[model samples]
Target: MSKKTVFKTASLTFLLTLIFSGIAFGQNWQTDFQKSLQTAKAEDKPIILVFSGSDWCAPCMKLENEIWSSDEFKNYSAGHFVLYKADFPRKKKNQPDTEQVKANKELAEKYNQKGFFPLVVVLDENGKVLGETGYKKLSPDEYIKHLETFVN
Candidate 1:
């Protein structure tokens, strides 16, 4: 194969691998609050609602990388919690739909009225607030333990 063709093929293969692997390993973050509530109730799990400014907040990005995207948290939370993300992306291209923006605003009013970025709220299956936290420099296991304190 020509060098150009080889490069293209390699790039395509890499992209595909990333996409499929992320699907297999990523944490599932529900976008709809009502749907998450139903799932939480059905699964008998607490709801972990996160409010983040994805494009603008440093702490938010740190938490996402260090905790939410960690293999340890992903494996543990898969069975224990219903995850939801309320993202406010300042970048125009990253903004969610209007309805989603509205819903996120409502959630913020109810749970994060202080407008704290990277806020993590633990709620009962019925959506009552159990506890809230923020970015902490801890290992995934320790973070999981901290979150469990809110639930149990």
Candidate 2:
């Protein structure tokens, strides 16, 4: 192969690697509440804790597909919030470990006592409740604007 061709291939490979890695890392969500809290404090950002039943809840799936997966929401949240998910799946295959289940239950007890699926609770670094929302029929940009009202 020509030297120029080899160089082009190498550059393409590097670019593709970076692009895929960025996509993988951009939607960072933590399962551990304490770890997420520590990260929120360190980053001096608020926490957006999500409670959902991934396998069974239709609204939870809709919220994730329509809002969380959107580029607008991802970009807006990437810098402003520490994301945490406490997923309670009904399927046996999707069940988390005992410790994680217990931790998620504890988090639900504190932040989601009524057991609302797709519950989103925003909290400051000190864990004070700033705002709470659930599945809403809004576009990603509109939803982000709504969240900004609570955060700012």
Candidate 3:
């Protein structure tokens, strides 16, 4: 590659990492408890809610980078479970709207306020709690194995 091209590539890589480093830290998990139940009922699949520290937490960002961004994760999550995000950020200036915030609070309360960053919950079609867990240092292969249960 040419010198200019190399520099540009490096710059782009840095920018990408920096951008993700911020918006990708504590993931603002979407909380659609009703929707999760609806989707689960429709598709006959479970629901997995991923709550993260999307802007300030290292492990949460690492999980997003090393695991969820992959084609493996995307492909696995597709056509299987209903995925919900319920995020709490230490620094998220341009956050979601009021309704979303209220819903997140409700879901957090529903989960008994064990609501910590990086909380992962699984629920049945009827919105019954199946499982809840915190962060784990899962390699891609290990992550794939973990995701298997959520898939049909």
Enumerate clash totals for all models, in the order shown. 0, 0, 11
* The 10-residue segment with the lowest total lDDT in model 2: 19-28
What lDDT does the true structure give each of the candidates? 0.94, 0.90, 0.71
Sorted by TM-score (best first), the order is 2, 1, 3
Q: What is the lDDT of residue 23 in candidate 2?
A: 62
What is the TM-score of each predicted model, taking all chains together? 0.84, 0.87, 0.71
Clashing pairs in 1: none
lDDT by residue (26-71, candidate 1, tens digit) is 6799988999999999999999999999999999999999999988
Worst 10 residues of 3 by lDDT: 21-30
Q: Of the candidates shown, which would achieve the greatest TM-score relative to the real structure?
A: 2
Task: State how far residue 148 of model 3 sits from its true place (Å).
Answer: 4.3
Best by lDDT: 1
Q: Report the lDDT tens digits of candidate 2 across residue range 1-152.
A: 99999999999999999987676458888877888889999999889999999999999999999999998787778888899889999999999999999999999889999999999999988888999999999999998888778789
For model 3, residues 27-58, the per-residue Cα lDDT tens digits are 22336678678878988877877777788878
Instruction: For model 2, state the Cα shift of residue 82 in Å.
Output: 0.6
Candidate 2: list runs displaced more than 4 Å. 1-16, 19-25
